[model samples]
Structure formats: structure tokens, C-alpha cells
Target: MPDVQIRPVTADDRSAWLPLWKAYLTFYKTELPDAVTDSTWKRFLDSNEPTNAALAWQNGKAVGLVHFIYHRSNWSINVSCYLQDLLVTPEQRGTGMGRKLIEHVYATAKKAGADKVHWLTHETNTTAIQLYERIAERPGFIQFRKPL
Candidate 1:
């Protein structure tokens, strides 16, 4: 296979991005409202929004997707980056595409003056944890959330 090329998502990428987005959501066994997805996509295209998306392409097809956001953190002067979502097609999972997508986000965050980049994955996702452990540190933080 050819090397994967990573690029910031454009408005034209919606058709390519949606399938990956749904796959990611399915992996987590969760779903979001269509309106929310629409808003998120729009945010990625808006220059004023801190959220962004990128796609990993191979042979002229989008095979992976990542969404990251920059946010203020009280601990630092520079904004921190949250790697919110990462997804690669099932067939492409173990082919280094995930790591490449992460590195792409790291490069983007660095360019945007972000202090740190962080993300979370379910404990059950052992396969991903294996790869993530090699590329990034496990800060030993557990996440908790409550829906409003």
C-alpha cells in the first residue's frame, strides 16, 4: 500500500468523513443527533472555531478521520489540545493508520501553539491501547462525565 497522506478536512470532505465518523461512533456503541453532527462538521470548516478535523487518505480515498480541539487550560498560557475522535476503517486499523492520524494531530497542535495533546479510550479497547502506549504516555488519569 502507498503511504497515507494526511490533510485538513475541507467542506468537500463531508461525504468521505461521515462514514468514518459513524464507524467511530459505532465502535463506542453510541450515537449522536444529526444536528450535532451537522454542527460539528460546520465547526471544523469555520476558521473561528477551535475545533478541526483531518483525514487520512490512501490511493485517493479517505480511510481515517480525526477530530481535535484547542481549549484554554488554567495550568498553562498556551491552549491545550483534546484529540476528541479518531477512527480508521476496520480493515485499515492495524496498518499504522491510527498512529499516523495521531501524529498528524500532534503536528497540528504544535503548529497552533498548543501546550499538550491528550485523549481517552475505553479500557476495553486493548488493541488500540497497545498502539497508543507505544506512541503516547498513559498519564494514569481516569475520566468521568455526566450528561446534562
Candidate 2:
């Protein structure tokens, strides 16, 4: 695991962080303009959005990020942590940082009083799917959505 530590991201990380962010977007085939990224980077700094979190190097390089949010759950009084984004730099992947990062979030969620941590991954994301299988049990609830 090589002491992969997760900490709150900082403004200085922007340069190191952007490339991984782009790679993550490429992985999902989602596109966004620079302005949206511009605003989002600011939003996290504002601290109004607990929905945001990022992980970086203790020695000062960006290794990965996990964008999550805590929200009230229907079945439990405790909140839910929805892991919206997780990305580890390509060179760092498969070296166990991904697992460590998620484990990091699991511990964070628990400490934050979250009932559970949840997220969705494409079925074709076999690598991540394998990791998820090892790290946590699937809720077995397939997700579906549509625009109103």
C-alpha cells in the first residue's frame, strides 16, 4: 500500500490534480468546459459543499481524489456517504492506492456517522468492479435514472 495517505486537497494541488481529473472524465467519456472546472475548484474551497472531498500526497503530489457527499438516508437516521468520484493517477493504479483510497472514505464515512457509503460504477469497469467486490459487498440494487 506504500503509505498512500488521503488528506484534504489544497489550492496548490490544482496543477497536479487537473490531469488526473481529465483522465477520470475521459474514463467516463464525459465532457465539460473549462469554466465548470473553474467554478468547481472554487466551490470546494468555499467549504459550503460537504459533497466535495479530495485526497493528495503527504509529500506534495496529487495521487488520487474521492468526491463524496453525506446525505440523510431513508432507512437510517445516520447520513449516507455517496462517493461520486474516485481517481488515482494511472501510474499509481493497481498498486493498491485505489483500494486504500476507498478504504479511506469508508473510514471517513463511518467517523462522520454515515449509515453507509455508496456509489455506482459501469458494469464494464471490470478493474474497479473487481476491486469493489473485494472491498465491499454489493447492495444488489441496480440504478436507473431519467430526466424529469
Task: Give each model a TM-score.
Answer: 0.97, 0.89
The TM-score of predicted model 1 comes to 0.97
lDDT of model 2 at residue 63? 82
* For every candidate, C-alpha RMSD to the true structure in Å: 0.9, 1.8
Query: After aligning candidate 1 to the native by TM-score, how far in Å is the CA of 112 from where it should be?
Result: 0.8
Scored by CA lDDT, what does every candidate get? Answer: 0.93, 0.82
Q: Compose the digit string of candidate 1's lDDT tens values, residues 99-142.
A: 99999999999999999999999899999999999999999987
Cα lDDT tens digits, model 2, 24-132, are 8999999999999888777667776676667756456778888788888789988999998898887887888888788888888899899889899999999999999
Candidate 1 lDDT score at position 99:
91
